[model samples]
Target: MTASALTFDEVRQARVALVGPPNSGKTTLFNTLTGGRQKTANYPGVTVERKSGRLRTPVGRSIELLDLPGSYSLRARSPDEAITRDVVLGRQEWEALPDAMVCVTDATNLGQHLRLFLELRQLGRPLILVLNMMDLAQKRGYQISIEALSRSLGIPVVTTVAMHKNGVQDLLDQIDTLLNQASVTGDGTVTTDAWVEPTPEAIRGYHQEAERLLREAVIEEGVPEQLTRKLDQVLLHPVAGPLILLGILFLMFQAVFSWAEAPMDWIDGGIASLQQWLAAHMQDGLLKSLLVDGIIAGVGGVVIFLPQILILFLFILLLEDFGYMARAAFLMDRLMSAVGLNGRAFIPLLSSFACAIPGIMAARTIAHPLDRLVTILIAPLMTCSARLPVYVLLISAFIPATTVWGGIGLQGLVMFGLYATGIIGALVVAGVLRLTVLRGGRQPLLMELPSYKWPNPANVLLGLLERARIFMRRIGTVILSVLVILWFLSTFPAPPQGATEPDIYYSFAGMIGRGLEPLLAPVGFNWQIAIALVPGLAAREVAVAALGTVYSLSGSEDAVTESLAATLAHDWTLATALALLAWYVFAPQCLATLAAVRRETNSWRWPAFMFIYLMILAYIAAFITYRVALALGGG
Candidate 1:
């Protein structure tokens, strides 16, 4: 078990930089080495930065491992790649110099992967080559002689299958030997012909060295990978690829709608029962109102989204865990490119449909600066789950859930429309931004298509649970706090004594909403909607609960006993419902996304621009929707 040792009590510490070409299993290996204790962050100024973590090997050696962004070579075109190269060469503006480097390479495609291995050597970073993906190499009818290759490269080499944790022991054994000797023996005799500085004269020399090394020791399998080639037939063909992607996306959303309904209904029933029991027992006053209307309705509004969030995460997790996402990125790059967006933007945007925060965070993976910004800016436009509650509320209220086209439901039709609107908006926005603000010439997409595999069940469960936790946390903290204050505002200026029934109209809440009504009238937002928009700033889902309470208070105080579903079904006008749904498509509903823009862009200017532009667009869209529908007589 003493796999590697540089114990404080035993010898010198090791600073290791993990260098790998893109998708060479470096990140998965980092997660395995560091567990869940790592922090992810973008480098200052540039959107993509280095991600590093501290790892203690099994033998108690303290090793600081930096997971550099995947780059094709040390000659970097992006800031992220530059930082990774600088660190390996110990040229960074911060932190102590690294002691050694681990060059992670794909064993199956060594010809394409060893380019980075040679690039790292040019940085003069004392390096060890990790022949990762050996299991995959073996599967493709190839074998590697690790000791002979190590001798040939004149550097320590270890063959590892990082995904399965196989050969990791030997990899560590090599690291310990390399690090131990660097201390006592001054640069281990282990070295590589791969080691050469990248000068105008030497860059080709290093590449030639790699080509030479690849020829003698590495054998071409004589066939393209069968599984990859087969999948790519459907996954990469321009016509077939987009169709397949659309189909997968449709199934994903379809599952979100159907699979989550039963669980949502169960939760809704539970909340209703709890509210009823509390009302029956508690004294009739603010406390009861706070628990039933404020707490149960507000908290329940957000928690009901858990099943849907989990459902979305299920597809995302399966795609990623099965190694299909890389292919997805590759396949979609062409369509995305036509829109002046990077194909890599598609994956991040798809993540945005789940929640914009992670989508924004994932944009760090895009190497192009303008592409990262464009992706981050348009990411929130994707219909997030926050938009889901609003969509479900309106669609379920106005449209029937009955099956259509012998398969899809009418309610599902609205869901599909809402999602389509988001996609169209993202593409249009990316096109505009590319032409105007983050304008740049086209960039070719270069990415590896990982082979497909069955997704791991445990990984799927853990991912779903994590997503669910984030959703609940947002509800409990931000949404709950806002709801309590809304309850305070709406509950006050109690109906005057001897006033006619259903007297919320006479309260301070009505007066405030009525004052704001004229501004929103063109958008089909009634006085009650104007009232809800104040608190809806906290979350898109909260607006659903606001409608639940304000309408209950406005029309029939007795409606506290009825489900909001029943209330909405009976009261809302179809034109009004359609207009409101359109408005939410562009509403700046989540403050968190705005806050993220500030963090990502490092200026109040960009975030402010986001809010201002979205609100203006939302108003214009909503106004046209409302007026057209009203002219058609509320169809």
Candidate 2:
């Protein structure tokens, strides 16, 4: 059993890095390389940082997978690009240099993305160029001669439709081969190619080579060109594009409220019925109360939000599939360009509407740290789905469900306003932050605008399923755990026999809230609002769930959804609800996101700082809203 006697060559620890331009399918490739053998970090040094994973080859050799930030070049203008450059070049001694590198380039846009490829070629590392998006390119009549590309680049070239995993086997095979090779793949030419600059001569040479290659191997039907041009006319229209994007975003929030109503109602009804049944069949005791109010109510409250979250994602996925998202990005790039942000940042910021955790994670695509940090700082302002429950609760309870603009629901209008506030606030804040902390001119808006295609059902379904899984996991894990703790807080210190406020009022939570009220007085919040922030740290949505549990523990036996909303309406004033909403717009509530920061930074300092700073901001914002509303003599 000796290593050499086994006849099989022992596997060496191979460090592999995945790098590509934004939207070039680098993530799909990384996921394919190492699926479950990965850990995600919340907050770290740069808002955008590498995610690492592990894989063992069939030969029992180990491989470390580094998912690097997607960047257009190695010029190192931003933290993300600097990281990628440092690790790839072994400039960062703390991080292991990649043994083999995969440069993922969009097959359809190779002419443009090739600039990075050309730059990477001189790095003198074992590298392979992955021609991703091949299927889409093929459909558009692109034909790449692999051998020709390999010869041209002097490195192995593997073509793949990464999303579909097409050609993955070949890519892996080449990677394994490259890993076992003696010299680095592109290292041999480094000494001779002393030029770091892509000089005018170099640019002319590349252009000439590219023209020759296109003439020799590439084929495109005139159809795709004409089709893309026609689509771009409407999609890229100055006035029309932004309007369409806004309408779509507005309709999405509306759908989150309106379309999910039936399912949400069904979930609420089922939870209440179960609770009553449990109370009837079970012996009266702590167990019954715990099941009904603590676990069931807390967990169920978060669960009902799944439909709305998924619906929000569905619209995003469809728009992206229809190829309009890129155009929207282009349109917004006009705005982002003014502030020195990346156009590639649009999708990540959009994702923030679902959750800032993923939104911050998604910023991995931005090449600049400042751009990513600004994006991360402002992402939480996008009115994530977590706040949807709170918004829906308050709006239903307070605002009359009358239509504005003829067809929109009155509740929908309020939700839209919250979203608008987030968006408008983000823009103004981004401008301010860019001026002060991250002052820089807009980065170049160089991004591939993939051509329009029919929405692929399989991909869409897979994406939806993934979102559903993550949604359920959070409810089952983080939300569920927080619910138990909140239930305990609201239930304990069983009321003194003579006390009359409510069981919860005499409970430990009630006392804590009362003690904290003075600090929150200007914010128009009562004891209940103060106490809920405990579990809210687990997630933003849990605040509503905590409210449901705390409110239910007071002996109210109504449905979790409407009952909570109505109770708040009856108990709190308009100013209180408004202040709370404003607080959520910038609340420092997600511990998971903080934890992510800790993991990414490998230190507790950043997450701790984040919590302290955000909490302060939230309090000030909440207080301002409350005092102003009170001063206006309105509740």
Candidate 3:
């Protein structure tokens, strides 16, 4: 079992942890090392994500690389930081201590970052210091004496531009060397007294030592942060920043429609061709009905929007990598403070745009209980990607595709409006909650603004690919399952002989929709829409599939051949389409989101309250929209 004598398989079992301060390029390093060989899950009994990957070294030995949550110190303040602390100290339940540590730091901000490195050194583990963003450091004219740094830090040091393919080879070789040595040296025993929470004086001492180390081992050649400051002058301006942010968002929505149109059309055509081939080749029976009406129609309707969803994620990933996300939080702090929320809550809320589940979980980063609760309550209103399918369907069916303001497509304009409505709703709800049940003064937003960098193509592509995989998986699993059940419900208990109405009229789903239609009538929802809403509780996108399935089962042969959008355009009024759109903007329809709220809050009461209030809002919004649109001759 000796380190030097161990085989490659034993080396493969070695676990190394990557730790760093927030925005220190640690994640970029992890991604570069691991590529697609990664798995994400939650640690035992905690909501913080556990990200680990298998990394094969240049020497052909593999090791498990754990990407721990970012932390500034071992004295953890938030749940995320606590996980990092526990894992590093071998206190996390069901998780083995890492064999070695890789402390990644922003090369340009080594003074502040080195403080954490000093603390990790006290743990008495085999540690390597990775100065990531070395390319950026070099551009800014930083001169670091690596030999002196390693001598002073008493550890091996390496520089990396983690976004590049070749940037991490040296770090990998260094890791292999460290693990090889640690195996022979015996387990690096951690001192029990090493991790006592440093007092204010001790903290100041650490800061002083870090500064001294920097002065002796590092030198700056040119004006530091010159480019960052120049860019921030415009991007961080009080007036221009918010305006620019809005313009970027507006453009993103515009691209979601304009850029993805061709791909969406291709997908639509492919689905139509598949349906046609099935109809022409297969014998007409229960199995044909299930395949054509249930699976293809349901899943295909949602799958067509994949291009648009990917476009949306592309914009988000690019902005995030460019470091404007923190600046966005900074810009929104004024308005966030006005609503009695810490600006830090903006990150979680922004994440909600992708999905409310992670958005709610992201709230664990907020320190104040009341603030975090309010954030969790309103996150679902942030217009997640789940709602995109429904929105696109209704908009394409009811709204004219003509251009407005000369070049902007009316559809994209309306899409932007829907996103704006969700944001406004979330802010209003947050304000009300803070004024009432969750009353509390807002905490000041104290966060780092890393220097902006070019978006890494590899990182962006990986993110987009991951999102696409998740969306497709959902279609294959949840949406497919729901569609089959819906098909059975809408097809079973065959219609009476010589029945005049469609066969689904006598089915169970029809009965259920009819039962709920009376209550939904005021909001302009028909029986078909009512049926869709029931399964939509499982996922917002499933509503799209539900509609496709319901319509395919209940419509004529000609209607079944038409796209869901065309069929809806022929049957529904503009008022109903607008009302449904309004409903989705407010409805807490996704059960996964509510479950996330419960888990994050550790109680059912908040989730119950969230559900009630959101349902009320959806109803009222739909009612008002229906009435107003009807008055405007959209009925």
Highest TM-score, which number?
3
Per-residue CA lDDT of candidate 1, range 213-296, in tens?
877786445345777678788787878887887899889988987899899889878877887788789999888888887778
TM-score of each: 0.83, 0.77, 0.87
What is the lDDT of every predicted structure here?
A: 0.74, 0.72, 0.84
Give lDDT tens digits, candidate 3, residues 525-549: 9988998787787678778766766
TM-score of 1: 0.83
Clash pairs detected, candidate 3: none
Best-to-worst ranking by TM-score: 3, 1, 2
Best by lDDT: 3
Q: Lowest-lDDT window of 10 residues in candidate 3?
A: 553-562
Question: Candidate 2 clashing pairs?
Answer: 41-596, 42-596, 42-597, 43-596, 43-597, 44-601, 126-185, 340-441, 340-442, 575-635
Alpha-carbon runs more than 4 Å astray in model 1: 1-15, 31-58, 62-66, 75-99, 182-203, 219-224, 265-299, 400-409, 453-515, 553-572
What is the C-alpha lDDT profile of model 2 across 1-635, one tens digit per residue?
A: 23343223335567888878766767666766676566543223554444788976544557788888777777665566777776767766467567778899878777767777777777777889998877777876777788777886688988886656445777777876677673333333333234354667877676676667656656552224467778788768887867877888879877877899899889878877887788889998998878976787667656777788788789888888777777878788867866656777898888877776667666765656578767777777777777776776777887888987889898767776777877887787778778986787566655667767666665466567767876777677766776677778878889887875667777777788788878887788777787776667767766776676567534322455567777777888888888888888778787667765555445687567667756776788788888888888757
